[model samples]
Target: MARFLITVVPALGHINPTMPIAEELKRRGHDIAYASGSDMQQYIENQGFRFFTAGFPSFKHYTSYALRKMFEYQGLVSNAFFFKVLIEYNRKLIVDLPPVIQAYKPDVLLVDCITHGGAQLAEVLNLPWATSHPIPGLIPSRDATPFTSWGLPPSQNPAVRACYRIIRLGQGLFYRMFDPAFNSIRASLNLPPLRHCVVTNTLSPYLILIPTCEGFEYARSDWPPQAHLIGPAPWGKVSAQDDECAWIDALPHDRQIIYVTLGTVQVFRSLDFYKTVIAALRDEGYFVVMSIGPVLDKKELEPVPEGFRIEPFVPHAKILPRCAAVIHHGGQGIAQDCIYHGLPSLVVPISQDLYEIATRCVSAGVSLKIPYPRLTPQRLRDALRKVLTDQSIRAATNSLQARFRATNAGATGATLLEQLARTKQPVYRPGSAS
Candidate 1:
């Protein structure tokens, strides 16, 4: 049996997708251990894997920092603040990981794409490692619009192609601002300076797995040789007692059910958005089950509308199957879950990779995208109406769901990781079958 070491940032979006792969590897008799923040210890242990604190600060610390600094600056300066926090956090991990590696003696390392230190550690240790991107659009491609542009639909028009080139140039200019900080970390570790952009630089030379299918993402012919488009890995906790959520069962079958969430991180910034959504959908005669996230108090959103039920937390795995549609922040975890269950979505992206995911949903014809600046009560209501009534959207969602369901992403990822462990090399090429 091969021994595996998995590393991830403390956020649920990054940690949860890795769970299914870890479970599959364990079921195959491999030993698995995860290094992350102490906050995730219970969740990791519950998944039947050994959990080790990576000796980094909690995610709350960074979130607090962001909250304090976000209003102080805008544009590039604001972006730099977030990146600096991640870099410092990863620095801590780099300092702490060597001891874990020496003790665990893992055969292969599974690194989260966003864990800056894990990629560097893998190189410093010279171990067989693969990067897992829970979200796509991080890896750049020449065949499609720049990932930062939010996955705009591809066009053969020369004007559109030229616009894409200009966008890529702007993206490069923005990324170069961090070269000194990123390279300083590399130089301190006796590593070479990166020749590529930050996102591509984090990729493993051995393999990179994305939990998405081709149908749901833009077609890219320029993906790296190490990249593999594994379908979405099904995950998340399921509520055990149906009786606990029996209110869902009691909701009248007459109206369509809509699951609403802005994801864990963005939900804190979306109180006004939530209020607007509730007001928009209230009179529409639809059932809206909205997860306001744990950080927010339910009392803040008191005087809840007639058709709305608000909770601090609810497992999407249970509620998604019952919903006719989903409204969320375009987080890859819940977005992919909606697609997996054949539920249409209306994505309102706040920031980060969310815009890209939301745009992809639009390109795939399974959802509509509403940028934060353009969000209005009427627009939200209209989007919901379209998502619920559009036969084409329903058909597209079902078609993509069929394709996603046919593939066992968990098994496929496990098998690929096993090959890497046994051979110490990537066995599957980009776009090849597992």
Candidate 2:
């Protein structure tokens, strides 16, 4: 059996998707070990994998307002925030992981697409590694717009594609702007200087698995040999605990239901957005269930008006099945869940790839987009009404839902890693021209 080393950040969004694939690998008679933040040790070990952890600072929800604000702003520090964190994270892992690499000697390494620690270790130790890309558009694409495009829509037109390439150049320039900071860390670690931009350098040459379907992403022909699209991680229905379960049973069937979430990260800036949603839909005759996520304080919100509900957190699996529509910060996980359940969405962009997700979902005809800067109570209410009544959007979501459910992401990812382990060669996609 081949031994695999899987690494991830502490965030739930990244870990949740990775767990299914790692579990699948273990079930198929492979050994799985994890390298992640120390905060995640209990959860990772409980899953029965050997874990190596570093003290990754709490970027998800640190108590420091200044630190939280730095991450929330997408202007200068978004990519820098990630690069800086992973630099420190990798510096720690580099010291701790060599002994394990020498004795255990993992045949294949799987890392979160955005993380640099595991990828750096693999390069130093010369292991064949693959990355699980949670957000596919982060990689520059010819057909899809870059997240740095300021809400540009996806298109295949030559002129539009040229615009995409130009924006990609700008993105590369931004990534290069941080070369000094990245190179300093690399020099200390005794790694060679990067030959390309940060995003290009971090990507594995052997395999890069995207946890999304082709139908969901904009059609692109220029993806590299290592890139492949596996469908979203399949999720079983989650049963809520006692009070929440009874409350779900009690939700009224008389009116249309809508699910809302700001996701887990960057929630510190979401109060105004949440307040606007509450004001818009509270008395609108629809039942609105808003999952404020764990980072926000409900005491800070204005008291809930009748017909609206506020939750600390709700599993998307539990609420999407009971709703006619969803309103969310355009995260890939929630967007995939909404599509998998065949529900139209009003995507609200807070920052980063959210705008790209909103744009792609709109391009796919499954969603509508409203940036936080443009969102108003009236606009949100009207958008919700249109999404609920729009036959075209519903049809697209239902059509894509079938495609999303047909493929098993865990199995596809495991097989690709298995192939990489056995051959130590680039695992070109089955039908890829690249």
**Candidate models: Cα lDDT each:** 0.80, 0.78
Deviation (Å) of 53 in candidate 1? 1.6
- Window of ten residues with lowest summed lDDT in model 1: 67-76
Could you estimate the TM-score for every candidate? 0.92, 0.89
Give the per-residue lDDT digits (tens) of candidate 2, residues 1-434: 99998777776677767777888888999999877777667657766678876436334534444445444766446555655655555566667666757767789888887667677778877889998888777776655566672557766688887877887777778777767766665676677878443576558889998889888887776787788788898554343232354577678899888888988775667788889998898888998888887567877786778888888767666677899999998888888889988999999988767777888889889999888778999999999999999999989998999999898898998999999999999899777765
Give model 1's TM-score versus the native structure: 0.92
* Candidate 2: residue 294 Cα off by (Å): 2.1
Taking every candidate in turn, the Cα RMSD to the unseen true structure, in Å, is: 2.8, 3.0
Candidate 2: C-alpha RMSD after superposition: 3.0
